[model samples]
Target: MKHYYFFLVFLLFTSCQHFEKQVPSEKELLQKELKAINWKEVDEYPSFKDCDKLGNKTQRQQCFFEYLAQLIQEKLSIDTLSILYPELDTIEVKVTIFPNAKMKFEPQFPKDSVAYDTIKIDSILNARLVDFPKVNPAIKRGIPVKTQFILPVIIKVE
Candidate 1:
């Protein structure tokens, strides 16, 4: 009975260690997915600066809107003002996109004043690599074969 007990304990210990080891197929799949993603070619835009020179608050606000429109066109290849806010006679928008991880857009407002008349826009966008095959030899231990990513975008109207 003593010998049998020792053999059972040894078997259990070895099995636990085996479970802890990473499956070779999973590692390979992750490596391949990481390689397929292209990170160097994304577009970026410069910051808006014209608003600082304007004397009037309303003019400064208009300058902000115009700057945002130009940035969106040059950076994201999207004309947000023409497509989204054509009817508004005067408005301002600001958007920031983080490194495929997060993005935000907000209107520039005065330090001491509230923007009661301006329109606020906020949104979040997310994307991920998916649809990995279950039977691929590169996918070990039933691991999924995709990488996840996130991005954020914001727009403001005045």
Candidate 2:
């Protein structure tokens, strides 16, 4: 009877360990979801024009960041608002935009597993100039007529 009990206890312990190991970590799940994104379906947003006129690299960067951020929020709200987990209440997604390219979301995860689950952007949003000055041979442009950008999307999970 004693040996049988000991064997049963060992089996239970081993089974629990296996179950725990089988649960995918938040990072792994997020990465998998991101990888599954179809980049071709993502919509492109208008690019920042006359960035050189901002006069400060830091300010320009911040402006571009904010612009991209808004775009991400709008797109997510329109396209993915319903599909998100109920725990996620609001998402503050950040995005970087680049000239002649797409907006991107950088990977970020909580160091502590308990903090929160991070969902990286599944797809990249392409950017294009909607309105901007035309480069002329006679005029020297102080403001950057064009620039590459990076965007981050922060999703608010409930």
Where does model 2 exceed 4 Å of error? 1-47, 89-103, 106-158
Q: In candidate 2, where is summed lDDT lowest over 10 consecutive residues?
A: 135-144
lDDT of 1 by residue, 1-158 (tens): 99999999999988897678665798899999888765433222221255556666567655645554554434432334434544433333344433332334454434653433344222211111112112111112233222222222233342
Pick the TM-score winner.
2
Residue 152, candidate 1: Cα error in Å is: 16
Q: Pick the lDDT winner.
A: 2
Clashing residue pairs in candidate 1 are 25-140, 26-140, 65-92, 103-152, 105-154
Clash count for each candidate, listed in order shown = 5, 28
Supply candidate 1's per-residue lDDT for 47. 19
Q: What TM-score does structure 2 among the candidates reach?
A: 0.35
Report the lDDT tens digits of candidate 2 across residue range 1-158: 99999999999988886666567999999999878865433222233674436766567656655765655555555554335445544433333334434434444434663434343233322222123222211111232222333334655332
- Provide the clash count, candidate 1: 5
